[model samples]
Target: MPAQLVWFRRDLRVRDHPALVAAAEAGEVLPAFVLDPALERAGDARTAAMLTALEALHRATDGALVVRRGKPEEVIPALVAEAGAEAVHVSGETTPFGRARDRRVERSLDVPLVATGTPYAVSPGRVRKGDGGPFRVFTPFSRAWLEHGWRAPAELPSQHRWVRRVEGEAIPDAPEVEANLAWSAEEPALERWHEFLDGPIDDYDASRDRPDLDGTSRMSIALKLGAVHPRTLLADLDRVAPKRSKAAQRSLKRYQTELAWREFYADVVFHHPRSAWHDFTDALARIPYDEPGASFVAWQEGRTGFPMVDAGMRQLRAEGWMHNRVRMLAASFLTKDLHVWWGHGAQHFLDRLADGDIASNNHGWQWTAGTGTDASPYFRVFNPVLQGQRFDPTGDYVRRWVPELRHLEGKRVHEPWKADDGYAHDYPERILDHAAERQEALDRYEAAKG
Candidate 1:
């Protein structure tokens, strides 16, 4: 059989991999990964997790996985020539950079560069309005996404052969990361998914908003790296829903919607690539923003004096991940309270987050900053104290991450300023008053609109 080169990017695992299945059916497959400088700008935690995942993939390929360091455009074609590959197969790319790089590689390749699937359950640009145009808002897009369901997970090839003629570099060592990274490889990610589906998924709807509990699936990095596909998760949800309780069913549905939000953001980026870095809309296009200075440093250091914001920031640096609810609250504090640009916060997140993706992280910041696809736009500022009290009611979440506030008991942790001994533990004073900053944020929004 002719040899084919399967260039793995975001999609790393072999199971439910459309490109891998297609390549296997066509010919003997050579699995290759390129350590492009462009894609290696992740923080220590993300880089460490990714390298670990690649090692797992290497073992899965029966020690035939090719790891090369260079631009994919140069590396892939060279591999094709060396292996005598008939064609190069890959899961399609959606992000602006990925799409452009793929196009360049396609143009440079001597043979066909066939694309079979994407990192998303539904590839960006697939779901559209009844009129065939892109959906501007999320609610409509999510409705259409559910209506336009995806295919069943792809089956593994019955019999496949590996092309091991070519040799490549060894996977490089990872930088030192302070936070703990749990199971990151394909098998481990799958194990975590099944565990969530069996138990925690039942209370996901109720507990997802709480930061104190391990209520989330923790599958963001898995999905981002394509250690597991969303299609597989969706299929499993369908299989287990009937056997589970109504609460589980509701939780499963909510989980599915969260996945939809990911896809929706990708679609928005596909349609408007500039939105990845700039404001999606003109809501805050000309808003006066303060430079990220001392206050910004305080926010990053988790010393913002707001226990909830401090806790979220501390959690981010410690774990390379933060609770989703806290992410929104932290973002709101930065943009609204400190008047810093959302991009600064987004960049910091991408640097530290193991599961960071441009579409989701940047757009999420934009959403909180009232500059993205949010329907209400600016003026909706989060009250850190209230948000902390509501979500982390017992203040356990704040106490867990913020050691200084651990001395404060119960809800007192959320509002240390109110307690006579609030600063007894040496926690920093509130950087700025939320009520005063809230009015300032609104005033800036009005000026920008005018």
Candidate 2:
């Protein structure tokens, strides 16, 4: 049988992987994973998670993963020649770098290079407005995306014939660089998804914003690594027996919308690749960036002195993740309060978050900075103390992540420095006054507009 090369990029799984299955069908499979220097140097928790996921895939396939460290354009052609492969199969990527890299590889390869849909239920850029233009707003885009739906999950291949003749290097024992935050990889990812389907998804709408509640799906890392395909989640949602309970349906819808947001951002990046580096709103390009200093360090170290902000930062540092509501608040604090450039904040998040996809991270920062399509208004800055008190009413979330504020108790934890006694010795004072900094952000926005 002719060997067919399966080039694994972001999609790393045995199940629901169309390209892998296709490669297996075509010929004896030679699974290859390129440890590209570009991705390695990116050196974030997400990259570490990818390496971990690759390890899991290696085990699942009985050590079939072929590890190569080079650019795909150069490495793929070399692999095809060495393996005598008939063709290359890959799950198509939507990011600008990915698209460009794939094009280069295709041109260099002597054999055919087949591509398939992404792990997402619907591929990015597939949904469009009635006028045949790409959508700039999410609501209409999501509506059309749902209407367009996607194919049902494919069955896992029972057996993949491996080609022993193909000589390749072994998978690395770990990521090239150490991860800044801790993260559970493939197995934990699967367990978390099952747990979410079992209970929390039912109460998602009512409790998701409540940091004290066990509410979110917590499957973002899995989604990012393709440990579990979005179809699996969509299938679970469809199977849910929608009862008259307002909370249940609302929660389910909200969870589904969050998935939509993931795809929405991916679509945004695919359509406007330049937004990866430049502002989505061309006029906002002039927005000033604050110099990195003590305030920025405080935000990164989780010593910002605002209970909710610190809690969110601590959660990210400890678990390689943060609650969705907290992500917004923390991001807003960086862009609007500290006056840091959103790109700097985005880099920090990418360095820590296990779920950090370039599409989501870049667009999320843009949304927080009010520079993306349908972004939060520049003048609407979140008050961290109020946000903490409202979302984490009992302060349990704060106490769990920011133990220094635990003794304060109740709503007071949100503003420990505001107590007549002032802050505890360990906890730092507020790095910058929110009201004053918020006004400065507005002034910057106004100046940029002029």
Candidate 3:
């Protein structure tokens, strides 16, 4: 029997994995996952999430996951040689670093290196506008994306025939880098998807912005890890659409648009690779940033003294995730309130968020900082307290995450400092005056434009 090597990267699952299935067709498959030193150096919640997914994959595969720690360009060739594999197969990656690394691996390998099914349904740079250039804005891009539909999800191989008895290294335990943040493997992700489909997706449009309710699909991590394919979710939406009431259809459409945003950002990163680290608009590079110090530390630690902001940060630290609306508010606080660089905020988020992907996190940070395509205007700063009162009105979300403010009743939890003097024992005072900081940010933006 011919030997085939299958490399696993961000796509960790066996079911509906095109590369794994293709490799199995050639011969007895040797499934391998490399713990690249570069990834470990990135050190954040993303790395921890990868480790958790790998552990789950091992369990699912009956301990068949091969573990090697090195650069893929060198390691893959070595593995291919040792296993006597005829060819190697892998899913394509879209990130700048990943693209470059895959190219190097392809050149180094002697046999054919097959790359398939990118991290998205429609691969980035595949869809374009009239002039044959990439779509600079999202609305037109989303329209073009829908017109260009994706392939149906592939089926998993039913049987595995092992030709050689090769013992690979053990799968590493979840990293200790972000010990405070709790992240589960694939099982919870599946449950979350079912729960969203069963309840919140029908009411998504109305309640998504209202952080108090479970209004959004929390399956981003699963999607990112490929434990669940996007097609599965898309099919579910279609199945339930006809049965839903008018309001539910409207809400479901809004929810689907967010998924499009994920693809939109992915396409943006693929087309404008430099935007991954730099401003998408060169003119906005002149924006000033505050020195990283006390305020930055306080923001990361969730002691910002602003109830909504603090709650978001606390939830991130405790759960390895935050509500989508709160994510926007928290990001706006960093870039607009503190005038910190978006790159700084991006790094911090990458360190904490379990679902953090370079395409989404980096672009989302740039959008909040007013430096990306379709960015929020620099003047439209989010008011953290008002946001909490308006969205999380009952203070359920705030109390759950920021326990210090638990004793404060009703909407008063949003501004605990406004309560009686004895309330000082419960919550800290306002960290930074929002009005004053807003003006400072405006002046800085204006000065940069001038």
Number of the predicted model whose lDDT against the real structure is largest: 1
Q: For residues 1-450, what per-residue lDDT tens digits would candidate 1 score against the true structure?
A: 999999998988989999999999999999999999987778888888888789999999999999999998899999999999999999999999999999999988999999998998899999998889987789999999999899999987879999999999989987788755575679999999999888999999999999989999998988888889989999999999999888788998999999998999999999999999988887677889999999999999999899999999999999888899999999999999999999999999999898888999999998998888853457788999999999998889999998888888999999888889889889999889889999999888888778
Score every model by TM-score.
0.98, 0.93, 0.95
Q: Name the lDDT of candidate 2.
A: 0.82
- Residue-wise C-alpha lDDT for candidate 3, range 39-81, written one tens digit per residue: 8755466677778888888776677678888899999999899
Q: Each candidate: what lDDT?
A: 0.91, 0.82, 0.82
- Best prediction by TM-score: 1
Tell me which residue pairs clash in candidate 3: none
Scored by lDDT, model 3 comes in at 0.82
Ranking by TM-score: 1, 3, 2
Better candidate by lDDT, 1 or 2: 1
In order, what is each prediction's RMSD in angstroms? Answer: 1.2, 2.3, 2.0
Q: Could you give me the TM-score of model 2 versus the true structure?
A: 0.93
